[model samples]
Target chain A: MAQTLILEGNEGYVLSEILKLSDAQHPTGYLSNEEYTKYFLKSVKGVSNVRKTLAQQINDPTITNVGIIVDANSKGTKARFDSIKSTLTQYLPTVENWDYVASSPAGWVADVAPSFRVGLWVMPNNKDDGYFEHFLTELIAPEDESFLAAQEMLTSIQKSKNQRFPDLRAQKALLALFLAIQEEPGMSAVTALRKGLLRHKHPAARLFVDWYENTFTLG
Target chain B: MIEHLTIKNFLAFPELEVPELKLINLVAGKNGVGKTALLEAIQLYKCSDKIGTNRLISENRKGNIIHHKDRIFASKLEINNLSMTMAVGDYKSKVFIDGEQVEGHGHPDDYPNHEYEFIRSGIKEHDWISRRWSSFVLTEKEELVTEVISKVIGLNIFRIAVTDQSIMVKIAGAKNPVNIKSLGDGLMRTFQIAMALVDSKPLASNLIGLLLIDEIETHLHHSVIRKLWKIIFEYAIKWNIQVVATTHSQDAIRQLFYEAAANESYQEKVQVLRLQIGRSGKHEVIEYPYEKLEFMMDTKLEIRGL
Candidate 1:
């Protein structure tokens, strides 16, 4: 529980993403059987019952117990970290802290709201255990030619950048260089993630993880 | 060519669905058994948009929206032999066109999409009603009277409701000097009828066209009624316009059948529907052969309400 995990912060961001995604009425809200049938079954009748279930799930105690704590200015783990320690004291029965989950103030309200929050479920390409990922990619990827091209450009650059370092050092070096290149003006979003990986130098890597965590933990 | 129409969705009678009709249709009901309602629904279906117009100013207004809703039935008016399969809101209602199913839209909006196109005889629909209207009375504001025959031939006309009986349809032109009240009520009614005929000149939708007149013998002497019937019958025959009017006057009915029986042209063309709506809330539109409707008044027919 005391151990620090590098990907844990990204996992927090994904959780936040999952909550936001679930916020819309489509996936998890008042989808009555009769309404669903009328919408899809071609029958003429009123539907009820689904709206309340979704409301209850959103109001449930489990997620309420899983509170999040975010620290804005850390000064490399100084009073900011102490503030986190202080906040964690009051948020009990919620795992003593977000030990099992990730923390970031970003998207806090969206994650807490019922029937609407649908956040990060799984990591992209990493296939990591996390929030569910059912976003625009499923529908747009099949038809969007531009998105396919951009995806190709990003992976190609990531590959070329990876080859610049030895195989053993490549994983760490790649992200650090990609992060730096991403900071350039008018940078492609795909390149930004790759360049963000460039900050994989131990200190910057720690920071990259923190940035990802804040995105999900802080609202 | 619907001879009769009957509907029963009133609180007095919950389940009565027979619209007994033949070549000559008649509706007879006391005070109110949804008699006028049945008539209005048919009118709404046929000409809802024409409920307003400037063309009928010299005549009389129609297009009256009358309603007395009950908690039981939403709207219960039995349609007979509707050819169009109307799609209203959520239901696909069937229509019998001379005992045959009409393919495509039954709803008025979908009328244009139906395969059956009602192409008029070399007359642009726009100018058709207007052309016919040219022959009608168009009085100027200064009370001058002139023929509107050319103006009404090809133009879309107007609609009328029961409440519209008092309003002016065809009016004096801007320069005319005749005051509308100066004319007798019978004259005003005649002007309304003429305007309506022009309004309904097959220039628009081609569904069944019926000119409904309630108490046609209104505000006129027996002689005037006879004269009016002759003119109405002639107009109905010439334009293929169907007339389904209600009247309590035997003198009026007798004169009509007498004229038709004596003349070959009036024999099969002129019709009368005997209408009777009872406390049961159901209406009966007994189609009379020739003008037997004129003789039904003497018959010992016992209608619950009437």
Candidate 2:
């Protein structure tokens, strides 16, 4: 019973770390944009490439479940979810209840075809206009004073005339600064999670963990 | 070309419905999924001599010609406007066309006289290739075949001659004609495929031809297969032949897509049909059109039903 989790960019590494912290059973397969650039889902060609990947996975009898995790970005949750549903419907026209499932904030998981179940999760709680960096930010230890310092540093930089980072990239820049001050400086966000610098039991993290476990039946 | 095909109670397929076929189609599936059986059904459908076709199909599997009464093979060709249902039972085989029983082995007056050639797996026997070579020599197709084989195998073939005992080929520097088999299995396989493709061309321009090749990648290197596909695609269009081949090699599938993608017109002419067994214990087909296939190939996705 092979279960695959497909992610965009370096999200696979982040999700791998999250799975390790949650003590949840990992999926059988993990695909990222690093390996399949089409998983970036940045353009029409990317989405078409992803549709082909989904078709291959759905037709595979060995794969029991497939999950896709993409950022909401500026499109928000509904539009992102709709895009995935549309791509899936092109291959599986008989699947129903997509709109009903899209109504939920927790994301959707159901058997779209015989012996084939698919799961979709738009990042940042699936109801907000943010990305993976925003999701990782929520897992920061609330009591950690350094986290507050990092936020202040980013705010002061933004207010300064010489600030180079754009407002849209503030969350990403904040995460980078937070990781830079860790015991292992210049490490990736996923490495920070691996070193226990981020709180895995945070409510936001638990919410995503719950959606993941239920979607893939990690129990 | 057969636009659509439906099979019922055929070998291994209780019921199967294939989507619209293209100029060149590659059928892929796991073992025992009936890729070969699909080709046999098409051969049976196009055969004018039912008894001979039934015996030949049985011989290919090394089985007896007699079959159970309930083991009836039925198929319908949508665009060709033909339907054939036959049962090679212990007593006698019966055939029907569009629900009308035909006497003896003769097809109906309206039956389309389409030509079909079934190339089974492995190399053809010396006599078989020799017989086909004799017929090919009678036509003006020898130079075309020699040139294609030369290009595919990287050998500068000057001429090809068939003797009573063996087939011989002369290279550019060869003092005398060498046995074709001396070149290796790749060369022989290429020659057989080229001959089949050229031989399938009908004398009448209006008549369409079908060429079924099982295990098309047999005895061929990955590089050689790509070159062979280029020629196949070219001849498929020029000769008005619809090619259907089965393969278990991923290289074969990938090369077919690459060759088709290299030519815009060939892109629409190619498709891949993956046969699978559904939860309901029935065989099903998943068609990958040219666009989808191109995407799968570009993403390096597995399309062999693995």
Who wins the TM-score comparison? Answer: 2
Taken over the whole model, the C-alpha lDDT of each candidate is: 0.35, 0.72
Chain A TM-score, each candidate? 0.23, 0.82
The Cα error of candidate 1 at residue A203, in Å, is: 99
True contacts kept of each: 0.00, 0.10
DockQ of candidate model 1 = 0.00
DockQ of each: 0.00, 0.26
Worst 10 residues of 2 chain B by lDDT: B102-111
Show where candidate 1 strays beyond 4 Å: A1-219, B3-26, B47-177, B204-208, B277-282, B294-306
* Tens-digit per-residue lDDT, A1-219, candidate 2: 656566654576577567668887644343443432333222223334545566667666666777778777788788877776777676664765556444456678888776677778788778788888898988888778878888888888888896787678788999988887777777787777877777777777877777777677453
Q: Which of the numbered candidates is closest to the native, going by highest lDDT?
A: 2
